[model samples]
Target chain A: MTRAAPNPARRIREDIEGRIHSGEWKPGTRIPIEQELAARYGCARATVSKALAELVAAGLVERRRKAGSFVAHPPVHSAVMTVPDLAELIAARGESYRWEARAILRRKNAGGADTLQIDGIHFAADEPFALENRTIELAEVPAAAEANFAAEAPGTWLLAHIPWTSARHVVRAVAATRAEAAALATGSGAACLQLERDTWRGDRPVTHVRQLFRGDRFDLVAEFQAGTGKREGN
Target chain B: MTRAAPNPARRIREDIEGRIHSGEWKPGTRIPIEQELAARYGCARATVSKALAELVAAGLVERRRKAGSFVAHPPVHSAVMTVPDLAELIAARGESYRWEARAILRRKNAGGADTLQIDGIHFAADEPFALENRTIELAEVPAAAEANFAAEAPGTWLLAHIPWTSARHVVRAVAATRAEAAALATGSGAACLQLERDTWRGDRPVTHVRQLFRGDRFDLVAEFQAGTGKREGN
Candidate 1:
């Protein structure tokens, strides 16, 4: 069989995506319609349709029955928790990383929906930039409490001292709470990214953490692998 | 190197968790305060403290200063993806799985703020029962359309038919829209789980999809190998 060059639809999708990504075509801005695009690109309408379909699936554009194809904006929040320290997470992206702790002490979260048995030193940091609340089992994972955050986040501190076996994460996009807004230095009603996680090692539940991230500043990603006989053994 | 059984904090966290998981303490139901629980459990306030802290992290409870801790009643959602097929996911825990396509059609999507290309087949099953909207790259993945949906979802179908080199995912929570509420078989204002993804074989983006799941019914989970060198390979 004669192998062909890349398909036309992919080329178009990429060409258009590149423009959008390059900000030549901004969100909410309509590009050429299918008919116009078909004429200009010298492809059949079906080809343009195919290319558009892939972009839609990838969540790059919005379409209506006859509204015409246009560019889609980036997700307000693209959150990925790949298990890196705060400094590393920010720094890995080539963005400058900075952090500070306001206060440090052993404290109790006495009220909420449940009584948390937190025993780690508590501290506050620059707004949503890197505000985090963390806990480590002093007994089951006694190494947690021994983490010396120093100028680092307790979250980073714990990661260095203890080795967690497993973790459960509960994440969401919620309007900021009054107190949370104040603590994170964002005004109330502003959109914020909330992450609530519970981690375990083997059969023992280890630590739980709740973190709030500025929506514009973060992205979360979870890569998928073929779960066939060759399941990537995480 | 002496490994012993878990300490008192683990025991207490487990005890309380068992109660919650066992329905001893239902959602929104008030539980004893720290002082009360500390005395009742016959452990030090510190031990009770540790236990509850773990629960908060696990998202089983909520804590408010001075107000006391109560079970965090809002239904906790888990990120459940990467398994390739929903049947395998449901059956992993030993449950009978059934899937039927309620709607499937080729449509055009105008670019939204999230992305720019929108042209593909949209598939939705029985609401939280199931929903998948993906782009079939006609230009690149010719077999996308005209594939089988009789026995599996589009995700499972394509995985079985083609071999793409790479994929990317964006998972987040979306509040139900009037249309989503009707389509998902849920009430308006309910939380809906949304995942936006882009996949590439290498440099070429091959596929894109956005899936909305019934929030009351699903959770997302991923296992990580600690110290896998550094997290976030990208």
Candidate 2:
């Protein structure tokens, strides 16, 4: 065979990914044998094997020792998540909203939020607001967080970003600190609500969020279609 | 004209999306004008206009006044995401999945640990014997939190049966509160690290995630590919 040059692994991986992306290989469908991939990519069997390994690392395909490498699923959602102007979320529901950025600190990588958002951005911390948190009216959205949420809460504001979307939320029990817990309201071991949400508009994720609802107040409500057969899009 | 119960707007949108996903409409290609789409879809200009607007809302297309609608940049990744079993995650890497159920709350979705989870299995806030919050070690899948992570991080276990091929991630900054700040080892006014991930294998959105990191000891890394623009699956 007039062989292709080096970077065989890259070529094979790309080829496999392209096939899956193009729907030539559907999720759960097995890939060609290592022997077959080698023949097609014009590389040694080991190189083809390595390419499959790379796909595994990328979480694009699965390898079953005897069953062979198979496509993971199908076209997964491609989320274009954005920080919605808070006011827009609330106002969309015909509700009014407000905000306040408490104790703003432009920190490089601050901790305290949920794990999903940690690798995402460097935030400007809070200030001038009691409890060192931002509040919102659930009605207005300027370019960014604005006003003091004396009357409105940030959680309420942020959650309104999407209408009739699907979410997987988590509420947990945690020990609260003196200042921070007091700020968001609740008590130590009082078990504040740690609400994490992966909000989706169809399959496109609108936002992934983790919030602490005051343990003292606030409740979680989730209503499923039970058996809608197949869920519909928003 | 013999029309087939024309939904010109709908057809136009599907055609554009098909072209984009099928690699016919390359990225950054300026889409045709409303008049052009009208001609192609055999519909009035307004019909084509509506279709494009809908695409924009769906995050699959973008328009720039006179610039016209073009396919928005697809997410860099095309991984199928799934809500996987934490044990499966680690075991897949040749490890063990272990955890202790701290508590299971049953409620109408209000207050404390019962406040966040809403799927109605109630929630078992678990303490992972081996837990990975923001970072899932490749050697060890760690724990993926699906809902009430305080008791049981869902990533530690799989609730649904789906295969994933790709993963999408987003990060951002948020202010910390007393309770959450204390748990994450940050100050009330400090910035926190957040990570949101959506994973896929093929076309299905198998899993959607939002993870918060202990900002004090977290880092986000990026591995870029050469400029070979591709297409989005979902």
Candidate 3:
């Protein structure tokens, strides 16, 4: 199959998106008017208008009637319910990533079954980003009992090995405890975002994890339609 | 059509749900064993087990292999993207709700169009719950210019008067600034959950709002299936 030429409108949209994403055009910075952009790109004014309109719909730009269009403030949005791999997330942001296993323990549960508990810190760009505590039911995933977590985060390992059928997320804000502050290198009572998650395979629980993120470093975003209660671009 | 009798399992589920909701059974309290519950309710052991399983699925109870089930810790969960009426939310919590409009201003936008700005505080049980700042585009909703915000919250009024087609939400955790702390009746540097929302009617922006919620008072919850990218029960 032969590829078709890119649409001019889409090309212009992507070009503007790149500028915004690259921080070349900061929020509230006004962009060129339709006529100027059309002249610069050798495209019709209508094409540039279409590009700007699409950007507005995508929440990348805002248009005022008499004033020109301007870049919209960028709020990093993440799917609230998805289990994102922190390593991949950091890498995607062009930051160095590191995982340190602070502690790991194996113990017998009330049912005399083996369980593994892990405490770790995820670093982005050599700075602590999140402190994580995770527990795995060894009976459900016996390999976890022997798996070496020093080299990898348990969340990364579980996402690779387990086929989770369902998940629940509880998100809250909290003051950083002294222990959390020391681990995250933040002052005590600093704001933190706490996310508690549980994943299951069919009827069996796979893992339960709690992650505390530096409030300044993370946030969650979701877009919704009027009646569907579904997120945009899902 | 006449409603059929409720299923016995569902009746049992609702009974247990009611108990949890009423705070009669606190978290970590062990519930009766299947046999004991069956005997108490005059039901089969299998029926009681089914009810407990359903409760586990609902995240209301947790079961261990050899240990009996226990009530799970409850976290108040709100939809992160939904524009909930704070008055209703507080009322549903059995708290007396009050809306106090701190300031209201009418200004002209860059395009020489009217805009309305509102600053308000929401109180639940006579304690400050949230500090809110909102801006409404008068061109989009002229009725807002005359609405008596002192008597009703702008959010509740907007929900009743306008039909928003889409909305974007950005959620973050932050330490409260002095001004916010004063309004929220919390200490400076206290953790707060900040939610910024922009709603649009078709392609026109209708309103933008920022609300700072006391961290100890609120949280969000979402449940999801493995692959659909859709929230459960949505």
Candidate 4:
């Protein structure tokens, strides 16, 4: 009937995970030995070992036989597909993030529901990071019809407001068009990464977005374990 | 010990899955209704429904409220990262695949182990599809040293001959340099999709490869479900 006591092994794992996630323990930084961690946490060495093993399984730590464990490199990969918030991604890189809306349009769909389309640019450290075009189905998200997207990125706003059920991402590289080049501050014909995403809430479509990023600045990375079907989301 | 009889529902699910995977049932093809499927399979309607439900959960089928289930679109997405065999991929597209080794170099590492480096071009239907540069650590994959890469791609060869423990992929867009442009039969500065991958056997590195695909021809796709972290391997 009462709450169960917290597991020490889980607590230790979370503590180490927190440090790694917060960037306090950079990649390659040595984690304390099992004996040292046991002494510090006032737990058995097996408990510390269990926590470290979990971290290793999660790809957050690497254990060397004679040497101690070390924080694994921060993965550049996203979950195969994820709806990441660009503002958060930029901020995490220790850069100032900004979003500027270039155009906004509201129109009626064939079903007589409103659709909101937005054109915008995202900046990191005052440099153009990506150009985005997004459409929101107002019938499914009526609140978006009145949202002030010019003052904030709609993607960020939508994440905080809507509950998405499924998403699809198509990633490709293309020559930057003149208009896209002008907006992204890259040379026309330069290679660029283009990502198109469609999100749905159950059977209804919620939003569709296309974002273009400068070839020099952005990339997608993914890591895999042999014979494992499971992947962690970003 | 005796093998248990296969569940009817599982049999139905596997049958449909095989058809979908084999491309016999293209995307958007409507599946027979439960009653029809039940009659065909000589099973109860509930069993058919159960099989359909499993297919839906696997993202291989889509069920509409008023309409029948349909074969979902072929997902372009790969498991976040996979060590795919290029020959198989090209052949799947019904293209004549060719592997041309432009150059091969063998060197000694600091540890005095042999390292083989290969530069090659992959052709699909007589058109260059990708430019590949690969390095294999012979200490981990000794068979690679004697492999006849001129007749076969090392990527495909490695996939067949070796067992890898893990892999990392970095995807980016890049402007093709003059040499790359010539090799890929594209104009200089044209957009290209570059994928750099490193595969390992346990803790020892096996191979490192970089492939450049024409921006217009190649892309990566991924699909995700809300609140779920599991991703299928390609």
Candidate 5:
């Protein structure tokens, strides 16, 4: 069997990126129409459009339905986010991990903050485990999550059910509150790792969760690739 | 003024996604070719190709240049990652954040474990600060980094110059060594927050950095959107 020809669309994307990086196509400059780009590249208009779409997704250009596409001004500051598997994490360290669903409630509070105010251990396995308090506003909880939470734990169910477009995470150390201490069987006011996460589907908010880990019990790990300066868009 | 017509490619994408969700198109099932899909959609073949490309990028389907596209088999586990700005964090807490470079050096070792060892504090702001010990393998350091390390800290310089496509971060609690204690002015063996991060540009590794935050000084925050089961692709 013969090998397929290289994708011209990818090449077109690189060419356009080269021009932008070289300052030949400055930021805020309007790019040629898809039809014109097609003619220049000797490729189909759809190929040019596909190439342009990638740039748009990468935050390099802005496309108006009629006004056409223009290079985007650089953003002030930017960051990226990722989520991990708790079971795999524990197993990796040769520890047995177990998750139990204690209770699921449908709460209606515009305040969007529901602290897990418990006076006893949430889950007491052979070893100590952390209590992850997930507080999501009703408005932010999606329909699928509503259905899934009835059957599975929030974190496990959400990961399988939703394909999130973007997310943000913040972690800080806080003195364990009375509730956290009772649940983890630890001393009050001990320094613990508190992770707060909120996720979205495009512009639609999904859920906001706060997980408190026994400082001695858990850790979070993440890995990524850096965009080469020339092709770095978003 | 007349509004531009809706993008046909996007409509084609939604249509294809609907079929997949409805089980008309099952996993590992080969999708129709661009020509056939275009004819069915009553649009240009390029439009169908563009639509298919989106599915391919979103991890819904796999496309072979010579063959066609097929729905992807389910993955075992998935994880997402993000990077946060430290300065913005300190400022948000109303504490002034300052970064001072104490030393930069070049060493060759395949072992890839080099802590930011020092006899004095690296950055002594008015308020207490976290001492991040980042270690990168020499092979992973890019040319830009080799030049930048001579002047500034790795994390500070890399964020401004390099664009990473992906990264992995691992957060764990560990006993601070004598060196870390001296730098942060904390007691040795204190349970500090240790963050290990490795970033890549596509398949090529960029840097592996380990940062130790004075447990009391910092926290991490993350937010994300779940992929709706229908379009749920990695």
Candidate 6:
């Protein structure tokens, strides 16, 4: 079946989105009414309505019952989890950033099954050092991953090379294993925080990483606006 | 300023969304092309494009470059976080749900600056028990909160009484404070999983809760899809 070469509604949608994205139409600014837009585009009123509806669903525009529509006041549904950078995180808190890689083993990471485990050591004088254990799958490792892993930590290396499009994170509490306690200079079965991250590029998953942090030394803080109905797994 | 009455494009968008939401249009199923949809809806082709674009933004439909649109294969972007119910969580795991309220204090929850703390006692046989400290603003505390706190845990109470439309959660790892160790029956320096949740009812903030979990016994898991350009902060 033949399709319209240049879908007028799509073109109009792109035009408005371009303005919004490029900052031409600032947040909360009102765009022209459908009638005015229809006249400008020389299209039917329905066409303008269709284009605006696209912007509305995208959270780019807000439509009130009787107030027409305005560029949405920038949604508040975003979740911020900074890229995993251990040195930067510690330095941000004005603490000395010290890292020691205990081991790096190559393994398969097919179907989200992880294969490599990297240990990050922290220097805690007279205190239990945190244990950060990360496991990554083999398939997701980049071509230069081995060299990068040897030169620096895998998390740091992956951050520099891989450009992931999406990521999911699960945070949980768990007791430190006996080995973990010894490694972190704590008692067996101490409390700890575990963070699991899965990153993907389009439909292809790039890597899944599991990190265990010594509970006493770290905290993750995030704030978000509510009720946009955008789910949390981005 | 005049608007078109009875937005035909909106009607078309809703009709399509309803079918998708109701499972009438199964995932991976391709509905009629835009030409056919426009004809069937008795609207301009642009009107149908607008409706389909909404579905695409919502992750409900996929539009190919030239192949037209189809119901999206079920999205993986949905973040699954069940309501915070201690009893229900335990029961769902095939274990008996048991909870004991240790303390409930009246306090202020100003601008998410929590002032109330709720302690949930664990019935652990020998493990280090966790303490949940919740601070809420006075403004968010409902009129009947005191009564509810005396009768049951505030978290459970708020879940039942307040109809929160949105929630934000921040997870972190932290060392237990001296008072916390004594209250939770663990060492003062022990590790813990801290969860801070702020709930809201529209523009009105409702409650902010912070819970410390015994690291050994709890884990939160969430999964999501990739490449919807919604930022982390909406």
Best by DockQ: 5
Model 3 stretches with alpha carbons more than 4 Å out: A1-83, A227-234, B1-83, B227-234
Indicate whether candidate 1 or candidate 6 has the larger lDDT: 6
Task: Give the range where candidate 6 chain A is weakest over 10 consecutive residues by summed lDDT.
Answer: A225-234
Comparing 2 with 5 on lDDT, the higher-scoring candidate is: 5
Write the number of the candidate with greater DockQ, choosing between 1 and 3. 3
> Model 2 segments beyond 4 Å from truth?
A1-87, A104-174, A193-211, A215-234, B1-60, B63-82, B90-95, B98-234
For every model shown, what is its TM-score relative to the native structure? 0.47, 0.31, 0.63, 0.66, 0.59, 0.52
Full-model lDDT, candidate 2: 0.45
What Cα-based lDDT does every candidate model obtain? 0.55, 0.45, 0.74, 0.76, 0.57, 0.60
Q: Native contacts retained by model 5, as a fraction?
A: 0.42
In model 6, what lDDT does residue B228 have? 37
Q: What are the candidates' individual DockQ scores?
A: 0.08, 0.04, 0.21, 0.24, 0.28, 0.18
- lDDT for B4 (candidate 2): 39
What docking grade does candidate 5 earn?
acceptable
Q: Please report how far candidate 6 places residue A159 from its true position, in Å.
A: 3.5
Categorize the docking of model 2: incorrect
The digit string of per-residue lDDT tens for model 2 on A59-148 reads 577789978888764222322222233344335546554454434332222332222112111111221111212221222223223423
Best by TM-score: 4
RMSD per prediction, one decimal? Answer: 21.5, 17.0, 17.9, 14.9, 7.9, 12.6
Candidate that beats the other on DockQ, 4 or 5, i.e. the better one? 5
For residues A29-143, write the lDDT of model 3, one tens digit per residue: 8999999998787788877997897687555788998898998753222233323566666776789778888777889888788888888899997899999899998988888
Question: Which of the predicted structures, 2 or 6, would earn the higher DockQ when compared with the native?
Answer: 6
TM accuracy, model 6: 0.52
